[model samples]
Target: MVLTLTTFLLTLLSIPLLQKLYTLFYNAFLHPLRTFPGPPYVWTDWYKCYNDVYLNRNWTDVLKELHEKYGDVVRVGANELHFSNPSVYNDLYSPTHRWDKDGALYRVFNQDESSFGYLTYREAKARKDILAPLFSHRATCEMQGIVKKHLDRMCEALGKREESSDMLFALRSFSLDCITTYCFAKDVHASSAEDFKHPLVEAMDAAVPAIRVLQYFNPWRKLVFGLPPWLAKLTDPNAGARVELQDMLLEQVKEFVEDPKRMEQTSNPTIYHRLLDPSNGPVPSLKSLHDEAMSLFFGGAESSGNVSMLGTWYILQNPSIESRLREELREAWPDLEDMPRLEDLEKLPYLTAVIKESLRLSPSVPVPLPRVVPPQGATLSNHPIPGGTIVGMSLRFVHQSEEIFPDPQTFNPDRWLGPDASSLNKWLVAFSKGPTNCIGQNLAMCELYMAFAALFRRFELVLDGTRSEDLTYSEGFLPFFNPRHMRAFCRPVEA
Candidate 1:
């Protein structure tokens, strides 16, 4: 009887192990992607996580090496294939292809209800359609004042700083304020914090790496993010600001939803106006509003700040680049008091080149935007990829390809100014392409222009011991810079 009972317990445990063994064998020898080449461990499910989370490697860098070894298409997981050839990028992300977003990669953000987090193109489109008007070029042009208001606030704060400011935090703070105010008519005042150490900014800084780790244990993400404000604060005291900001957004969303007439009282039209309007579609649930607010706020702040910070970092390394940028800004504006219109700013060839080069060199969403092949399968790079296979090609592959951009690592804006520069737009997939591209792109473009122009035109900038080493980053949903952040002195130019 004792022996029989022990066998039953052992059998229950071994069942899961046996299932894993069968999966390994099937994935290695009998699965549809069996012909694809990868490291033997790719047959196992946890290898990418091992490389990304456990071994602590930059996953994209690893993909570069693996592509070198195994050619353009490599099976990176049991059902995942990562493509390195830039040719496949256009094919996968083209407007004609409306494949669902790969759930495995996107679920990390835990924003399933937001436009970005919606899996199917149809679902994403519904949300994007409602949100689209607010991000249109016309709308962005009209809303440039909102961006400048926050920029002015940031510059004022910078003027008061007695020492070098944290450029990352400063830019992030500016972006946070812009997004919060622009989206909800609420000023987070992230830029108003002393020396740019806003708690919300700090919490975001703290949250990025944990987000990278959360990929491995997806279910744990719920546990981590679901923690109550007090419990989250108790668990990680720095989370107080993050939780506070989230709670504030939730309250605002709640207030708007419960009494949507409050949207009429806002200084500007908020997302709540469109989202809650019955004509556009059914109003998203309160929880979904909370999710969308967090998604847009964090994504807007992080991406804009990262691109601007990276551009400034590289410019400080190349004084010629900075000189040319300042010269163009000075010419375009003529007087510091009278700034160029967003349209005029877009027309400045050199400024446009600088911005394009910045976007190309440092893609904000550099991760492999994975897409699942449909049930009927698909053809890419002349290879017939199997149905339901999770396939992705990272923007890093497209942006850094030597064939497309010679000497891709160098910060040379001239690349975008060449005679054939008109043709390079297809290769520039920074905001991505297709039906589900970034919904906030026009707004982001507006923010980048304002941020970069202000950084160069309004101040005489100097790096404060921030070297190239400090800018190295590991890939998550976004790039997570390591060791330290970019710091600089922003002495106001005497107009």
Candidate 2:
């Protein structure tokens, strides 16, 4: 009787495993996604899909290749669809769409429940509404002096460098210091190695990549979070780094909260002050304020810095383009010390074209902005797409399309200048378009124009023993070129 009971229990245990296998087979052959063309294993295994993404180094390129093979719309994963058609933009990011955020990746990035970084769509929208004014044109204009001071300091720092340092690293520090000062009313001074050595900066950097990885293994995230802080540190260095960063931010917020008079004394408006007033509007918890501030600081800094580096790289590689840019700068501003005001930079047509061209060639955020399809379903390029599908447009592919940008490989800023400039501008979607566009664009542009104007005016940059075509890109959550590996020889130019 005992033997019979044991055998029966073992048989029962095998049933679920068999059922799972059967379901997998059924999905592979009979599911709706099965009808769509993709790699054969995409339907059967998630790991295989991830492997393809990793192997390709850039999943966007893989998506483009698949689209070419299968059609404009291809089932790239079990539930994910890749759309190459421009109309995909409308269906995915449109305000009217009922689709909710499907990617749980944000959850891993969240510092705590009270932080804005973790907040759902409803919360994010509410926060955006309250905070939008702070990043406005008027707001950015008010902050121009603050921006310029930091830029000037950065230029000084670069001038002092004995060896050719990565412009991205220097700019990253500058942007970080600038944003932190605005947000916290205290200078983090991330512009120098000594400043970056501060515990807070080190921790935040470590935590960011950790959170990205943790988001992938969603099943055990809560358990991961629940681990002792020390144990968590062992598992994810980011968690430890995050703890230090958060502690620093919290301390600053506490100081502000304790001294209401201190908050009132600000002549210049900041996002922190705007969010602190309950009657002014719905305010996120102080904790949320801190996280959001950090997010803005890091996001704004890293992206703007990378773009500056890439833009500089492209200009240096093409000497004619560099010379033309300098001529425009000279015409725009005769005196190098007399920095071009924000308004002055705006009127420089060639400079604007150079910025646009650089963004097209190397967007800082090249990854697809992933969005889920709504329940009502949608049409992409006249083809009906089912609801609940994951969809995104690859900016890397879209910007490089030969139809939109003729001779796409060539670095031609004039395509954005001259008579055809307006037509070319219409096709430019580097910062993205519509409601979801980058809020910090004005600030980024201000820094870009200022940096370019300052650097080119003062120094002539040349590639240091490295060919432009031979420079390799390093893959991160953001695409940053290997800065140290690629060097530039800078010769001081006579004013």
Candidate 3:
């Protein structure tokens, strides 16, 4: 019996070895990507998971090194390919392309039926039409009041601080408040806090590190999410906050359902007003509504928060950047009491350049946006990619490539200034491109411009010297900066 058991265990162990040998042989000589060059074959997918999930290595840096070693196109995994060519990026991500969002890769996000996680082009397009109008220019203009209220609160709080303040917390508060207000008429008041550490913000920050783990190993999520509330809190204390966010969203939805007329009667009619309206073609199911709300809430909050935080850090690093930006802000709004309209802010060439340059240098979403080739097949950068193959372009590759932007790593808003600026727009995929690009981009831009103009125009700022490592990051779905990195001392400029 002991000898038989040993044989069975050995056979099970040998199965994986045989599978590895098969994969290597197939990838090297029999796969469609057989001719493509890559690093020594060692299970690229597991290597990626180790670096991204375990070591917390920056994926942008990892892909950048691979591109440097293997040229513009490199086979990064058994069935996955990475391209660094900007024109090819335009081709693959363009609306004209047939590439669909990669199902296997996107499944990790755990957002089902939500636009961000939609796998089929038809369903995604249908959903996009329903949600896209809410983020249009007109909608953003209408929503400006909610944005301003939060921005004003943030500036008011920051102005009262006597010591160097942590901009990460403050910026996150502003973003969290803006998004929650947008989702429901209720405001989280994250920005109104003196300490800037709102409970929801703290919970969201705590959950991020663990969420990245579930993103790679998704099956375990079922186990984690299935635990009873009390036990789940013990396992992932922040899990309660995540549930609370969804619960709040559902509660708001319930209000709309209970009294449909209340949508128009509310003090702040939010995105939910349009989504839950009966005149709308078809209302999403209750779970779908929650999924959509949660997706938009995170999208609206985290991306803008990161931009506000990282942009401030970089702008302060260079004295000239601060000088030029402040000059532009002061010129645009001479009286500190007079706030510039969002449209007027858009017209400030230097301010626009600074925002664009910041988005390029440290994009909020700094990871690869993967897409699957269609059954008809297509070629990227002249390399024929067979249908069903997973392919993506890392924004870091396009943004940081010396081939596309000279001195790409260095932050210079001036690069975006002048006749070449229009041409440079082609390579700017910070908010991504084509049909599946970020839905909240217009609103995010408004938040960024408003925050920068409001804060910098009123205060002269300098970074706290001891917090240099704050600029360093570890790879999550979004760039997670060391919270301590963005501390800055501010003084009200003598008008």
Could you say which candidate leads in lDDT? 1
TM-score, structure 2 vs. true: 0.87
Using all chains and alpha carbons, the TM-scores for the candidates as numbered come to 0.97, 0.87, 0.93
Clashing pairs in 3: 470-485
List candidate 1 stretches off by more than 4 Å: none
lDDT, candidate 3, at 162:
87
Two-way lDDT contest, 1 vs 2, winner:
1
- Candidate 3, residues 1-495, lDDT tens digits: the string is 999999999999999999988877787779887678877762345667776777777777788888888899988777888898877878878987646787656776567768887887777777777777778878888888889899988888888888888788888889888878876777889877767877777777776666567776778866875677677668765677777776788887877777888788777766677677667668878777777787787777777777777778778888989888998898888998778989999999888988888788776777778888888788788888898778888787778878768988788888988778898988888788888888889889999899989878988887777455657776667766676657777777756
Candidate 2 per-residue lDDT, tens place, 1-495, comes to 999999999999999999988888877887666777787678764632365334534556667678888887787667777777764665566666534444554455454432235334565566666777877888888889988888877777666665675555666777777776666655666666642244444554444344435555666667865577678678765567555555677776776677756777764666667677776676566767776766676667666766777788888877888988999898888877787898888788878888888788875666566666667777776767777777667676667878778899777888876676787664567676544556678888888888788878877776666656544553334564543434565566667
Cα error, candidate 1, residue 294 (Å) = 1.3
Global lDDT scores for all candidate models: 0.87, 0.68, 0.79
**Which run of 10 residues does model 1 get worst, by summed lDDT?**
475-484
Kindly report which residue stretches of model 3 are placed more than 4 angstroms away from their true locations once superposed: 1-25, 42-44
How many residue pairs of model 1 clash at the backbone? 0
Error of 3 at 241 (Å): 2.3
RMSD of 1: 1.3
Model 2's alpha-carbon lDDT is 0.68
